[model samples]
Target: MVRAAMESGELAQVAVDVTAEGTDKLFTYLVPRSLAGRLTPGQWVRVPFGGRRLVGLYVGPAERPPEGVALKEIAGLLPDIPPIPAPLVQLARWTADRYLSTFPAALRLLLPTEARRQEVRTLTITNYRLNVDDVEALVSELRRRAPRQAELLAYMARVGGEAERAQVLADLGESIAGPIRVALEKGWLTAGRVARRRDPFADEHVEPAPPPVLTPEQEQALASIRQELIAPPAFRQPVLVHGVTGSGKTELYLRAIALVREMGKNAICLVPEISLTPQMIQRFRARFGGDVAVLHSALSAGERFDEWQRIRRGEVSIVVGARSAVFAPFENVGLIIIDEEHEQSYKQEAPPPAYHAREVAAERARLEGALLVLGSATPALESFHLAQTGVYRLVSLGHRIDNRPLPPVTLVDMREELRAGNRSIFSRALVEALDQTLSAREQAILFLNRRGYNTFIMCRSCGGAIQCVHCAVALTYHLGDDHLACHYCGYTAPVPSVCPSCGSDKIRHLGAGTERVEQELQRLYPHVRVARMDVDTTRRKGAHAAILKRFADHEVDVLVGTQMITKGLDFPGVTLVGVVLADTSLNLPDFRAAERTFQLVTQVAGRAGRGDRPGRVIVQTYQPDHAALQAAAEHDYHRFFAEEIRFRQELDYPPFAHMIHLVISGEDEAAVAATAQNVHRVLAEGGFGGQILGPAPAPLAKLRGKYRYHLVLKGPDVRAMAAEVKACFAAARGKWRASRSVSLSVDVDPVSIL
Candidate 1:
């Protein structure tokens, strides 16, 4: 029998573009009647076009070729690449165009990178239960076999068990697959297939992950989100979670997502997964169970493909993962909760598109009628703007669920501390707070945004600071390694006792960081068990979770950390928070600095007094008059938002208006500069009624060898702005392609164009 049918016909032409532009500039292709078994809709195929063989991603059989075009049958079917469903193809098309990504480009990129090959075994089970009739049939068949084989079957019947393929193979000693196939072919067995995934949560009960009992505040937040998700008629709405630090926003997500699943709809959660440990995944899994699909860059190609398939098939009821998980393939997406929505990690900085996960998820929810709950204690300015305008409903769990009063925040100016001649890492006020909290049997947290041992390696005589050789940045001092390292470029060097240029042994380190603060806290309070969390310490898979768990379990009396301490981690015992450096992010060159500073201080302040012990925060900063510090100390988000929005409106920034940044990058600095200039000129000439600033270098311009130049396109008309930028891109496309290293990115309604 000829199993493969023949759709024999003349070669047809199909245009396929695998680039980001997603152009399906149709090329000619033949339909192989002989390969009818393989020639299916959305099957991947290679083709000969324009003097070269290209991977002509199949879009389906074509009716005819254009005049003067030669056609060829799909050069050959990519047998391993799975067929893409027609509807998904449309969705991909829609996303590509909507996001201003090229259509065919988006489609090709959407396919699993390892789809062509590389399916390997981890481990899985095929469950089966034999009926009485089946057992009887098996016994009869065995009785007809040789005595030993018959005895084996009789033993199986008596045991009333299903044998693993490996066990059967070992028992048979040879050709186990054949016998299993024969038994199935002879209708003597039943089978159910299952696939193994990398679920580390299944193991490791030494530290169990379970949802904590929700406090009243947490319950209120969850109840609000639940109502939004279950609202009748299912109109799309954005719910801003304004819970302060340690307010159990994540716990609310667990409950809301669980409710979403219980309603027979899928829920997708986006976290900075690559930035988290296995223990975090375990927590999500422990609460969500096997129905939760964890997707991130850590998984193998095959694993990602399998997980993506599970999402596409709606086999997984919930997905907990990172930035790109916003694209999880669930048609009936009921809820999307983006935790830590304000963190810059939610933005894909390295990629050309530079998309923020929160924006993407919100946009998707708008399209899918899914309830979008942005769970952030430090809500981004964009979200705050939306909430203020009533575009998004603001729902806050204000007080810590423990019903503890808001932490008392006090700022200690470093200038005063320095003037007082006490150069210790801890300020007098902070030390006093820590002692008081510890005496009360409550935990204290000291936060230093910097992660290194010190601010920099400096020559005392010449006052020269060590800098990264490759980057325009100072090297950070690491006491543990006696090393000077660049945070941006990963450049490292041994600390020099004698300054190389000065030839002096007088080398001094200035400024304190997490490592220094942890050292000082332990030295000053020898009896207290202290744990430090920072980028350096939390690099391990379960480090953050382990530290958080230890702190929650009261294994650690004091937790000294960096900014991670601020992002929602609910603990029942923390009572004191010391901001070792409150002005770190506050002093950035960007206008958003005030907003970031305000969020950071308030967030860390909210972290303390979350337990029943009445948490308090002591902020040490040089600028006591800073508005952000003042507003934060007052726990005044509304005042902060108003002032920040006023600044934004004065500057004609987003929310008040619309802003889009057209970023151009290339190895050729001259070329990028030219492109940026041309784009600026185009926007200026387009008669746009708004700001057209900077055909100039961006913040941290030279990154990873790419000379980046940005053309800031701002206007009141968002649609006009987008169209103008699109025109600018279309004009620059030639220049972009001419340079292999050159790239372009468009960010619409960007939260922080930087």
Candidate 2:
């Protein structure tokens, strides 16, 4: 059969890894006779394109070569790397079609950063093994003349007659290199190269943890999941586990994964943030030992490469990672669990194929006949709508594990505090609660979404704020560095003695941030141990783990951080949780501001009262009577969803209609605006049935030194809209040549327009 296939001159359809516009489709290439039997779909191979060698994915055999065109031969296959599974290749195609991205861009999502760049290889080290028959006699003869050599030989003998070169040196000292060379030369020991896997958890020790008894609610949720795993439906409906905080949702996931493994299949578990990986990995490793592999951005390139290799080789049965883990290379995936399904981080915003992991996981599960479980304390509105329509299996865990009472939330009206002459950043109630918690020696978490010392520096005389030259947003004041920095673009400038607009010494820092809160806490409580966790402080590797460890160890009396501390954190020592300003996210210009505000406040409030003692939350907000805040204070997700969904339906926002956000940006504002108008015209002329909302400046008008103008297209079907967009652009290319100065970006089902 192989000979016949080769004789038929089978042509390979390859998707070259170049991201140019016209190169989005597949190109035909001839398969060499030597690689005829080995070349398969989804295998990475080298091919000649435009007089240069480029890496491409072989996407199976083409029916025939392009008419009257000669094709290049498949240069070679990538060595040591496993071929991407056929299911993932198909998934990439579906993602490209659904998300309106290039085939090559979608394929890149299925590979590790270093591996796709071909910058990493299989790491190897030398191993020394004892080759002599009479090891005891040899040691005795050498002990008198060379004590170090004798010690090295004895140590190797003690360690199973073979040891790594580095381990041998570390065990016996660096002075034993000469002795090792002498032994090798005298035929007493043999050395050979062996593959070594770089382990990210080499320094940590995980003890096996036995399974705990599950609560009734957890048991029922697990049963529902297990039923689907055992006998999935023809068109399997994903299981949406809507459980409140501290309800043991994670435990249900663990039990379901165990069931999947029992049936000889693998699983993938995804977390929204990198900060959540360490704790999640610890729990998974404690239960599954070396069978759980981790993948995230915090790991070194070599570590990521090795972990990907391990997953590809099927050495691990479970994968715990960030959003990208959804595409874990398992031949038979039985289950995929998303921990925080509502998180905005699950949606990729940049580099084209802006896919939501939840959507991708659902597609992959359908392809592989796997069960998907989306567990979240506050599920996204779209997901809940599906559950309401009976398109998903809804399982709820309303109570805590031991029926611990939900933390009582107190909404402190900051406006009232100001009327009472309490002009401090913290309200009177929050200050009193912090003092009491400190006096009681209990830990607390101060949640502030902002990061710098002050949000912006403004001049009192001219009322003009210092802004970043690159972006339209104001520059934040960073006290640690004594400089003004742009959070959006990282542009830094020295503090000015006088206001630039009016030449008066009336510049003042305004708006409190995490740094200011930490400072105020220390000022109020002189000896308080306060640690801040935010983008500024947690930029280093292992910084998140370090701060979290200090808090968990009770060394930190107050933990001040941004949204990083909002979810996936369980610290029993934390009895008090305070939101410095609950109104921060509520005032955003986006449509999902209310939903985000509710999720943030609710998730953060859930962190308190998890220990033996009762927990209390103090939320400081100017909008005390806001419906979102009221619902969050009552711990009522249903109420918040009802109000928010009604608003969404009225405005034809996300859950009611799909949207495609098109942004045109350039250094030249006129060019960007002109391009935006042209795009709007093209779509309208192409016979689109949807409502086109804008050809106006985006909410963030300028970003990273570019003027941005956007248009929003809303309709019931996104795929049809995507098709129309492609056809319109293809038709308009010749008539109105798009300037090289302007660039356009398309985001299908965007999480946020800003």
Best by TM-score: 2
Model 2 alpha-carbon drift over 4 Å, by segment: 1-10, 68-70, 143-150, 274-277, 734-738
Q: Enumerate residue pairs that collide in model 1.
A: 7-33, 8-33, 11-30, 15-26, 21-102, 22-105, 29-72, 30-72, 30-73, 609-615
Each model's lDDT comes to 0.71, 0.90
lDDT string for model 1 (1-754, tens) is 1112124554444546445342545555666665654555666676665565566556655566567844455666654455555555565555454455556555544565565333443346774434345555657666766444455455456657565555555766665456566556655556666555544444555343666788877777777777777776355468999976666677788888878878888888888653355545666767766787877776767567778777766678898888777767677778888887877777655433445677667667766678988877668888888887888888887766566578778878889999999888778888877878788888877777899888887788888887676655678988888888888878789888798778889888887778888788778889999998888987766677788888878999988887777765667687788888878887776767888788778877776765566777888888998888888888887777777888888888766777676778887888788777766766666555668878789876775567778877667877665655566556655544435567778766555655
Candidate 1 overall Cα lDDT vs. reference?
A: 0.71
Residue-wise lDDT of candidate 2 within 1-754, one digit each (tens)? 3344457577888999998868988999888777866787889998889988888999888886689986678788887788999999999999998998999999989888677768988899999999878889989998999888888888888998999999988877898899999999988899999999999999999899999999988888888887778774595678999999999988888898899899999999999774464677788888999999998888899998899999999999999989888888888998999998999999999887999999999999999999989988899999999999999899999998799999999999999999999989998889899989999999999999999899999999999999899999999998899999998889999999998878999888999999999999888998999999999998999999998888898889999999999878889888999999998899999999999999999999999988888899999999999999999999999999999999999999989999999999999998888888888888899787888989999998999999999999999998898888888888887343256788889999999998
